[model samples]
Target chain A: MINNQFLVFVKKEFAHVLRDRKTLLVLFGLPVMQILIFGFALTNEVKNASIVVLDQAKDHQSQRLIGRIGASRYFDIEGAVDDEEAIEQNLRSGKVKMALVIPSGFSYDLAHRNKAGLRIIADASDPNTANTLSNYLSSIIMDEQAELNANVPVPYTIIPEMRMLYNPQLKGVHNFVPGVMALVLMLVCVMMTAISIVREKETGTMEILLVSPFKPLLVILSKAVPYLLLSLVNVGTILLLSVFVLDLPVNGSILLLLAESTMFIITCLSIGLFISVKAQSQQTAMLISLMGMMLPTILFSGFMFPIENMPKPLQAITNIVPSRWYYIIVKSIMIKGLGFQAIWKETAILAGMAVFLTLVSLKNFKIRLE
Target chain B: METVIKTHELTKRYGDFIAANAISLEVYKGEIFGFLGANGAGKTTAMRMLCGLSTPSSGSAEIAGYDIYRQTEQVKKNIGYMSQKFSLYEDLTVMENIRFFGGIYGLGSKDIRLKGQALIKQLGLESEEKKLVGSLPLGWKQKLAFSVAILHSPKIVFLDEPTGGVDPLTRRQFWDLIYEAADRGITIFVTTHYMDEAEYCGRLSIMVDGNVKALDTPSALKEQYHATSMDDVFYELARGAKRSE
Candidate 1:
């Protein structure tokens, strides 16, 4: 009996969703746009940064150092500056992100004194770029010095060997793909489900449905089923884009990733149901879903901002946002190649939230019209 | 006549304000019971209680031999309801709305298909079955809503101002449909502010300030109040109402 009724109800819901073109676009287009934007355009890696050099020595070593810095893809040599004042002008005008100063007698000091002095200055206005450019330049100089000392043995030269595990190239796509998955799923499931349910109330169809013999829980469940399916489709789209377009592969089990995503979707649907029960109109539901759910999913999920950088009180609040847990789970399974044993706590928390929200919303769902 | 709906002093209250007072009434089988009132006269509140959409704060009521409080599912099964607002899904096609409503009422697929065809044919919407409900005129939508309400052969259909915003010719046609359902032995409990529509009911109840001020046939009400028309009778009862919308 339930099978027939549920099928018919779900079919009606699908018709509602498909007939509206605007909702369809948001459901499918948002994740694709977000993935492409984050993958290629909004990246943390700095490349081809412009820099000015003050080469006072004009010797073989100083010329070689400037050649090495320009040769690297990290910096673009924007002509040489003869004086410290010129370097200061380039830095202040933002014409150069960094400036290099090579002292005189550089090759003689390096060969006889076994030491050379080179000062690197960077514009600290954009701190991240400044820090990254300075580090890149220092690394290039270190490599040149190591090559110079290839034949002569040094007493105590300690070089730290660094290995970037999981993401060897330190690609931004690897980080944002999981974050986007969490964000897109949360927005689509929560906002769409809430609006759909509250829309019935606004249109007066909910009154008719409530008056029918159909159980109220069945009605609410049927509303959520379509969005759940759509959210899963969204997840599939995001994952495919990440793999094919972004070139970010799932390092762990695909089945596990899908399973965890389904859990998160269910949690979001329950939240949507809760909002629908509390909200009286579509506008209220949309506002609550976007402001109440989307903002926290973006801010507290540790995607755009680091949770640790926030105040201690806010860090404690981040624990309650379900996306925070889902973000960690996705990163663990997708990036770290971990299994269920690794993400069991997060999965358990999500499951607990799903069950708890479903119960609360169901309990609060009024069978009788007020 | 067999009693289909019986209420003993049914009352609903919200804190100190009473939305529906101790109003006792009964609706016999196959009778057109007109619930008449002003805007805030509590006509809707009483109908909501009888339809099992709202629980009464005091008194008792029964719908089709089922206790309203305990057997609400059974009560819902035997009744169909249309609210003051347009109740059909605007995005859904005519045939789709019929099938969905029929499906939720536990009708088999074959039954739904047959009933949907008959309903569409009877409403003269054969060419417009594929069009969305919102695209139809207000009169057509109202007629379709009425037809769908009784699709499952429910014992009673409750209409809360089903024809509020429509042309007079359309309202006459709507009343014709109501009369036909009444002839098929389906009890229609309708609420309306139109005095002309009130005169067409077999019996009418006028409410004022949450209390049933008068209950009888329209002719008897007119005679008892010595009024010329149902409008004069309604004004005589409702002019004393303390609440105004």
Candidate 2:
């Protein structure tokens, strides 16, 4: 026989969520907004970065090299600094990202000895930008050298052929799609469920629900059902956008991906349920979920940072974060095209978390209406 | 005169604070029993225990032929609770709220629809039945809340200050609903701070600082204390009460 009370409770919860405009906005708006922003505004590709040049020689070759570097779209010659202190000041003041120091070398060096040296000082506070800046500058100088030696033959030249696997374009969107999915799922499933349950407590409806014929576990299950469905819909929206708009393909079994997503969503919902049980007010529930879950999910989940590069203690802590395993599972399945065999460990971890959280929340759910 | 509710020294304590001290009382079926108390007088604590919402620290009680401690599920199924805070989902429409409460009580769809329609007509909310409950006036919401609480025809309905924060006219109309439910043999166990509403109960029990200071019919309580009204009787009993909270 069907549970009449469960159906009623679920319907009420659905109505509450659907009718709330703010919740509806967050449920649908946040995922799409995050994807679009990550895709367009937050790309790593540097363009027209301002740099200062200090040419001590001021010779034809030095001027030529500076002109060549400035001609490229990646570098813009902000000014010609005459002194090293001026270049340092410009870099320190954030007026320029890099400073090119052309040494006082005679043109006879490059023309006769076939080698000349230049120095590039970059602000390494933002390591990624510094690295990118150095790489771009080296490529430009090397391009000029290749042109000069076009007619000459090198006896032993080792050309390294590099190929980027999976994401050949190296689009930042591909890097962020899986991470965004994990963050958004955790937000919708964990944070929203927590606030919703605590809201009932704040409004005194939790007491009424406990007093009903429905068991507390069943009540929790009913609250989670709609969010589960909604999170699945969020998954669909993210996937459709990632595939069609962002061009990130799902190479592994689509069914396996969805199954893992469902498991992760359950884990997050259980976490939210546990938070609701511990918190007495909606504000407290929200604070706990956001601080305890969202921050950890974003930081330790390997969403933005590589978990391996982190310190040993931090890496061990990430082992318990559900988002870390979920990110690994989705990335392997979606980007690496790895099947269940390759991701069984992560899947098992997520499932274990789900079961543990469910048990804890069930134990915390008191039937006493207080 | 069957006893629908019977309690013996029902106590609830948190740490050293006694929210509901060792108190005992009873009420017959179909009797409108007024559980009167000042703020934090343990009337709500006692009612919460009876409605199976809270467990007693010690002693025992039987509600509608079921033990409050062991047969909590049965007790829940037999009784209806209307908290003073207005326990209906404000986001839901009037009809949806009615149907939800009705369905939880295991009523069939046809019964929910029929009873829901009848309630809508009786409350003169035919036009507003589809309207969201939050948009309605407070008085109308109170009446609808009470109706929903008794929709399942439980053996006893616990209303904790159901008429709180409403005007006098609305409260009068709300009392009519309580009297109607009591006339249909549903035991009305109500708690209120309004002394005038206490007079409407068939028998009144005034609690002072976790103890039932006086228990008798309204007229008998007044006569016993040589007071003019329930207001005076309440004042005389609560004058010397020592708060434990």
Per-model interface RMSD values are 1.3, 1.9
**Residue-pair clashes, model 1:** 0
Where in model 1 is the C-alpha error above 4 Å?
A43-174, A367-370
What digit string (tens of lDDT, one per residue) describes model 2 on residues B1-245?
Answer: 79999999999998898988888898999999999988888888888888777788999999998988788889888888899888888999999999888988888899999989988898999999889999999999999998998898899999999988999999999999999999999999999989889889999898888888889999998999999999999989988888734
Instruction: For residues B1-245, write the lDDT of model 1, one tens digit per residue.
Output: 79999999999999999999998999999999999999999989999998877889999999998989999989999999999999999999999999999999999989999989988988899999999999999999999999999999999999999999999999999999999999999999999989999989999999999999999999999999999999999999988889989
Model 1 clash pairs?
none
Writing each residue's lDDT as its tens digit, candidate 2 over A319-364 gives 8899999998998998779999999989888999999988877776
TM-score for all predictions? 0.82, 0.80
User: Which pairs of residues clash in candidate 2, taking residues 3 or more apart in a chain or in different chains?
Assistant: none
Per-residue lDDT for A1-370 in model 1, tens only?
A: 8888888999999999999999999999999899888877644568899988888889887788789888999889998999989987887788788888777767677777777677777776555455456668778988888777788865213232322222334433336888899899999999999999999999989989989998888998899899989998999998898788765678899999999999999999999999999999999999999999999998888887878679999999999999999999999998789999999999999999999999988888874453
- Please state the error at residue B135 of candidate 2 in Å: 0.2
| Candidate 2: Cα lDDT at B141 | 96
